[model samples]
Target: MVTSIILMNVERSKINEVAQQLADTEGVSEVFSVSGTYDLVAICRVPTNDDLSELVTRGLLTIDAILKTETMLAFKAFSRHDLETMFTIGLDGI
Candidate 1:
């Protein structure tokens, strides 16, 4: 999967609306309202680079409330949740 962390600058009045839209968008796994230089952050996981491109250019950027965006492509993922799942693969029956 191609994972993208998208930082978005949205119009102040539309932050909530835009976040909801992003969360509802296909390929977008999560949307967070954060405090910092950006108003919101969206985590997207998609099948291919082409899909990511389509999602950003056509899906995300098309939102009128989104003033700007910075997309970061993830090369690798390191998470404690993944480690825990790996170690517990078949322990559920116990």
Candidate 2:
């Protein structure tokens, strides 16, 4: 899976509507209304780079309320599960 962090600058009057639209879009897993340079942040998961492009360019940009967006591609994902698995490796002797 390919993960991306999309930061969106939405029209001030339509932040809620834009967020809802993004959340409803396929491949978008989560949407957050954040206080920062960007009005909203969307987490997306897709199968390929081409799908990511379609989602952000064709799908997300089509939202009339979204003024601009910045997409960040994730190179790797580190989670508690990964840490636990690492620490547990070869620990049976303990």
Strongest candidate by TM-score: 1
Instruction: For model 1, give the 10-residue run with minimal summed lDDT.
Output: 79-88
What stretches of model 1 exceed 4 Å from their correct place?
80-94
lDDT by residue for model 1 over 3-94, one digit each (tens)? Answer: 99999999999999999999899999889999999999999999999999999999986799999999999999785344445567696633
Q: Each candidate: what lDDT?
A: 0.92, 0.89
**lDDT (0-100) at residue 1 of candidate 1?**
90
TM-score of 1: 0.84
TM-scores for every predicted model:
0.84, 0.82
User: In candidate 2, what are the lDDT values of residues 2-90, reduced to their tens digit?
Assistant: 99999989999999998888889999988999997999999999999999999987997689888888999999977523444556869
* Model 2 vs. true fold: TM: 0.82
